[model samples]
Target: MEDDNISDTDRALGFTIPARHARGRIVRLGPVLDTILAAHAYPPAIEALLAEALTLAALIGSTLKDAGGQLTLQAQTDGGVVKLLVCDYKGGELRGYVDFDAERLAAGPEQPSLFALFGAGYLAITFDQAATRERYQGIVPLDGDTLAQAAQNYFVQSEQIPTLVKLGIARRADGSHVAGGLFLQHLPEGEEGRERLHTRLDHPEWEHVAILGGTMGIDELADPVLSLETLIWRLFNEEDEVRLLSEVAMTRGCRCSPEYIAQVLGKFPVEEQRAMAGDDGMITVDCAFCAQKFPVAVTNVVL
Candidate 1:
């Protein structure tokens, strides 16, 4: 899709088709994806769900124009095996975690549908601007069997951009996990930045490209041997040209640290901090996203 250089792991590629008035993103997550999921010791079904959510986060998060901004995806259920799920991406740094009832999950089916797993839940996507501290969020129903379908609902309802999302995940013999996803949208028409989406959903160009995109199978996405460049070329080579943009590198990252934890703990009252300390006079704060613990001494920290 670009030059000879092509990334097969832990990268997101952005591209546009001028003639079709469309643009898309492709993400391949390897070691980083493995690291994020393995630390949780989740069941296979839970891990699969999180992998898709994390990959979806990366696909759309990388499109943020502001380098300092962040994208967060959260799913919540009132009565289901999984009570909560959250994932976020900033500057290509990815982290996610899920909270669930072990007993309930153990009794669940070998594979559960979205409604079966969540019962009644909603998925929220939030964009946080680091510079202006502005936050925009959109919430949609968890309708389809896959998270990819939920994302599509978001684009069609909130963004009003005709979109397609496909995700795949596979586990190797070594027990490591890999995930990949594609996000394609019809570029709106108008002046440079002021373009508006085609209110009528039946554009000829979008229909044609979306059909080609729909032909992609989920298995092809999770194939370790398949390069993202090869996949893009296979799908859109019939077009005049595909302009591939720079690739964004993704990695396992956590914002949790001793100093950061202490700063947050400082906001609590001194008596409350004392009650949280262990016999050793230290409070250990655990981060679910990274599976890391930070020890904060009440005496050392201003609480």
Candidate 2:
């Protein structure tokens, strides 16, 4: 189900601290995270990286001006255990996958550094507007200790908006995974336009907000019991006022189906399609994000 308002655990929300010239988003993923991660049976390190990517997607994607727009976070590397990582979000739906060298990962330390996992990689955040068909993307090197730190650098270095992010991942006693994140940005006091030319390098209000966000612990963030609203109030309770936004529910949204698979297979050359068919004369396609297989009969594919 999408946007189910009954539960608060698997949802993301945006809020603003007008008094401090700042805005932020927080997300806590429960069963949705478990479902997507369990489908692939990835290694623990890969799972943690993917979880952070998903959390960043949701935290940033929720800010899309057009509800129909899509936000994609991609990381590519060379000469590393992890080769590529991708995650996308649209209308409160998220799906992500990671490609890594299993043998190399097994030989590495139990908890590898970002450099160990991705020797030389870059992180890209792209937004595809729904109505305008316009695409905006920011690319930055994987330079920080954690993905969250890299994201903060993304906004500061690429977008030039001072930002901070705290991402957390945890496993329950039952061995189920969960993730959460916080994204805060300083909107300097200036003109009411997309480009606020008057952004200060050392804004006092932004520092106050960032310091508060930095105080949050990973355990506190990944805790399933804390509501999103509570997390916000906990940080800004002493402030003059804080406005809460409506929550957007999330799920393991994988855009894959048999009909769609058949349509794609119909595009391939008939000879190539037939050559790829299995013993049953069917071309089987597996969706990487969902780990679901779709078999289309060669006879039905006419390209």
Candidate 3:
């Protein structure tokens, strides 16, 4: 059944299948994704990849332990489609961008797979918690065919947690974008008991749920009319029980502001700052995340 309580777009629903001893999260990104991608006119392939990255970031961010913290997912590659794709999630806000070779992308193969687009690359995930001074990061080789598969590999290889991830992205006739993802993880039983158990391999329940998840098609996942609750029920209703834990709202937001840009420019030498000024005697700074432009006056800046 669909949950009438939550809004239609940019939301995540966390659930647990106690009978299977597994936890999962489903996310729908509509207007938020459209707004983020609309900020820049990227090629169709680049836009799709960015949407996938944003969806993955939200899925991982919703599972963070820290309330006041940020999760950053970055993909660095030496390929024709994209060089760098970064997405950051903080609170309920998400933003991302991509750097690619335009000429190469235009001349490359049509609809290249993730591995082909990011040939021999790495995916890095960083966690920055406000309560702690230390930042944690994990790196994994991008060996999967899709970003979602790579994420699954990360949890299994780096975190040693059995996980399955699926992501879907689509473009509407109006040129807007929509993205959604499903994440399932087997929670650790206990540290003491885990060591005693020896190996934390995949369970039969994990395989069962993963097979059910694979039945979902990209159209169903990315459909704006499909409510997350309905989708979850459709996927796991046959199970003994599926419980909805909580819901989180997501938005399209950037951490860029005039003061922040001014502070960054202030670090440069006076001559360098002057050289950055335009003919109008104002230094213009463009934010890569939101594509917002900030024009700063020389006299107004304190350097």
Highest-lDDT candidate: 1
lDDT digits (tens) for residues 118-212 of candidate 1: 88899999999998999999999887888999999998888787889999888878887778899998864621222335444567888998999
* lDDT (10s digit) by residue, model 2, range 1-303: 223343346899888888887888999998998888988999888998898899999999998879899999999986779999999999999999998999999999999999899888898999999999999999999988999988988988877788889998988898987788999888876212146355664788888998999998888688777778878888889999898878889877898888777788889898888899998898889888998888889887775
Q: Using TM-score as the measure, which candidate wins?
A: 1
| TM-score ranking from best candidate downward | 1, 2, 3
Model 3: number of clashes? 0
Taking all chains together, each candidate's TM-score versus the true structure is 0.93, 0.92, 0.89
Model 1, poorest ten-residue lDDT window?
190-199
Off by over 4 Å in 3: 1-7, 190-199, 266-281
**Residue 223 accuracy (lDDT) in model 1:** 71
lDDT of candidate 1 at residue 243, scale 0 to 100: 90
TM-score winner between 1 and 2, please give it: 1
**Greater-lDDT candidate between 1 and 2:** 1
Which candidate, 1 or 3, has the higher TM-score?
1
User: Measured by TM-score, how close is model 2 to the native structure?
Assistant: 0.92
lDDT digits (tens) for residues 195-236 of candidate 3: 324435567767887889888888878887888888898999
